[model samples]
Target: MKQTTCRIRCVNALVLAGVIATTLAACSADPGATPTTEPTTAESTSPIDRFLTPTESVPPTAYPSATNSEQVANNVVSWYESGGEEQITGVRDRSKEIYSHHAEDNWSIDFSLFFDRSKEAQEYPPIPDRKTQAAWSTALKHVRSGASDIYMSNQLGIVRGSKEVKREAHGWKELAQGVKGLKAIEARLHREFGLDPLTSP
Candidate 1:
């Protein structure tokens, strides 16, 4: 009877161990199978995906009509004639008011070119004659040079110190010459192009 009882207890202990081992094995992940990963969210992928986004677009500005171009040309001439030259020259005073006025005037002239009329004038039919083209090119060069001179003069004038003030005075002289050169080119451009007179106010 004692031998039978001991045998029964050993069998029961073995069964219990086997059952625990099986349970552990089932709970653990399968090493032979492929590991699954969660899908990536947009926020995580946004930087890489941004290159696929469409570009934002803007509408193009239209060129000005012939009548508007003529009027703009006339206006430019009138502006220059009506003491525009004086306003720039008067920067020699170096007063805050004078500087503001000069800057405003220059900006007005520069901004005017953005109008449709100015675009039309710039896109005017090309001249066939080499001489005429050369003249036009020269005039354009002068206009650019004049604008540079005025800008440089204004910059130099803003420098603080007596020496800078003197330098500013010298810059004013150069600016004056540039203004004259541009005025001359303006006249030539108007006459040659058969547009409204740029020199006549």
Candidate 2:
């Protein structure tokens, strides 16, 4: 009886060892069953990921698309170039139309400069109704000569304007600037104003 009991106990020990070994081997072989290290609950996220994650980022519905700055500036330049009063007026009107299309917090800096020039042109001559050819010439010269400077200034101004517009526009500008293959005026637009001039139809 003692020998039989001892033999039974040895068999039970062997069976337990075999069960444990098989379990470990199966766990290793089965990817789903394998034990995995859990990620820490306090893991950090990237700056970009944090920016992308949506929250209560409510921006104004009337927020104007900041894309029209350069175009409006060019149009103003076109106006001055037309030389014909009717055509110049038409160009100015079109520029106003472009400016009016979106709800800008204020006119873009370049656009504002153009507007001020136009206003000054309207106010030319001491008489309330008299027109001055000299004013027209001066306005055109100021606008044309300062085109590059105005563009650069406006590009930076748009970036400043964007801060007051909406959160999405602000964030879009930040991301678009980081994108590859953007530089010069195009990059400036994307970076400063969130306008993708290259891909827009």
Query: Model 2, 54-115: lDDT tens per residue?
Result: 53231222222335656544433233233323323432443333334235644343455545
Looking at candidate 2, the ten consecutive residues that score lowest on lDDT are 124-133
Query: Where in model 2 is the C-alpha error above 4 Å?
Result: 34-201
TM-score of each: 0.27, 0.23
Q: List the residue pairs that clash in candidate 1.
A: 64-116
Best by TM-score: 1
Q: What lDDT score is found at residue 186 in candidate 1?
A: 43
* lDDT score, candidate 2, position 3: 100
Give the residue spans of candidate 1 off by over 4 A.
Answer: 1-125, 156-201
Candidate 1 least-lDDT 10 residues: 89-98
Any idea what lDDT model 1 has?
Answer: 0.43
